[model samples]
Target: MTAKLPAPITLTGRHVRLEPLGRAHVPDLFAAGGGDEEVWRWIPTPVPRTVEEMAAVVDARLADTACEPFAVVDRASGRAIGVTCYFDASAEDELLEIGGTWYARAVWRTAVNTEAKLLLLTHAFEDLGMGRVVWKTDHLNERSQNAIQRLGASYEGTFRRSRRRPDGSWRDSVYFSMLREEWPVAKARLTERLHAGAAVPA
Candidate 1:
């Protein structure tokens, strides 16, 4: 199985538009979610303390060939309130992991995450023709786990001590995935949930 790596593209939804992550978004992103430890808790990198640090982080993400990042812009505010990405892609395997996601507290209990994910998944399977889309979160992040499950991904199991966190703690990676065959049902459920203004725990 083979697939092309996702190219930079904008995925628009009712609540948000996922623009290709760029330097221009750092200011808005910083204003939106920067300096929030809670938002960066499960993230592997150091919590950015300033806009400059945020720019450095964004640059690092953009420099990585394996990462295709997006700035999650609020449709109403037109500000980048968060970031998400297709990470560690394997074109030869028709697989990629969706990781490195973070959002502002303002959008936490809203439909923003649900709609943003719908856009990404639609493009992953329908446009990129990917066979699988994966998500892995720290075992300690129950909210993230719940969010992934709510997206109709099946829990694959845990990988113990998969990596060390920025704080040097061993991270047990909890894995979930949605296969192409199962996408129709998941997509239907997600679309319905989106209409209901569902609050995702991601």
Candidate 2:
């Protein structure tokens, strides 16, 4: 039997909007994702270099039931600023992996990134009733590792030489996960941080 998929989720946070990614989002997404070579350095696929390429990628993603990607829109500017996804969703195991995340440098280190993650995690754990949410990053990407740790996800060790990157180099991947038992505390902490950041004067 085919596995059941989670209903398309549209999540809006204090600083960002998460809409199901579609072809229409390509033009804006290409603009958001391009211009930053560093952001795509650790990513597996070549960064979308043009609007047509971005549209093709979004189209393929839309056709894949296993992956539910979202266009990350900055609420302040009302512009799409990045992309994220929940891939490798296993309904039978009540588990899902949140990966393929990339954001523009303009929003890096801001509350918007955290809010986007909080929205995705909340939907995965509380809304879809998932037992665990998994996160992984290239071991060489310390920034990503630190961000995941800040989310209170337990470090599950690294997979040595796990996969090859687009640059023809081996990438050891560090894995992290937050269990259902840990969700309440994690959720509360993230909620407090997001609310506090929102109240700050720009």
Candidate 3:
């Protein structure tokens, strides 16, 4: 099968469902994270001070051909609690980056993030036949780095002066990746953790 950008689809797991992001998710998305400094701290964009600003963020992602954005809905609550994306898609290279991820404070230490990664990684490597899935975060964001490492991604390296942060300071990005040949082992570990009730550490 040829690797390609995933078409808009719903990915369901025991803990959450990732749906194609849309305007309908805006209210819940805003309520979930808008203006929460801590939630947006490590993110590239500044904290959106209003729902409209958050909506613009979502809209920009939607307009970008390179990104497939999803609204992460908690199955138990039936609410959009977060956002994620499969971005920087390269069909020929058989790879994509799983970035632009953030969830509400309420779901921060829950199974939501773990299961969401499971669903996304499964779809990328299993369904789309991608050879690699990449993840990156600010070098100082230890919490995010730990979460990515917990998912079994190997630390590729750090990219110095990668990009300017919202506050106008330069950010050094820490990169990690998992390969297709390594999927079975990584998948098994992630699945076991999810089944064992492992959550993203606070």
- Distance from true position, residue 61, model 2, in Å? 2.5
Root-mean-square deviation per candidate = 1.6, 2.9, 2.0
Whole-model lDDT per candidate: 0.89, 0.82, 0.90
Each candidate structure's TM-score, on Cα atoms with residue i matched to residue i, is 0.95, 0.91, 0.95
Model 3 stretches with alpha carbons more than 4 Å out: 1-6
In model 2, the runs with Cα more than 4 Å from the true position are 1-4, 198-202
Model 1: per-residue lDDT, tens digit, 118-185?
99999989987789999999999999999999999999999999989999889999999999999999
Ranking by lDDT: 3, 1, 2
lDDT of 2 by residue, 67-145 (tens): 8889998888888888899987876788888888888876787887778888888888888888999999999898888
The number of clashing residue pairs in each candidate reads 0, 0, 0
> Residue 103 of model 3: what lDDT?
94
| Model 1 ranges with Cα > 4 A deviation | 1-6
lDDT of 1 at 96: 83
Against the correct fold, how does model 3 do in TM-score? 0.95
Where does candidate 1 have its weakest 10-residue lDDT segment?
1-10
> Model 3, 145: alpha-carbon shift in Å?
0.6
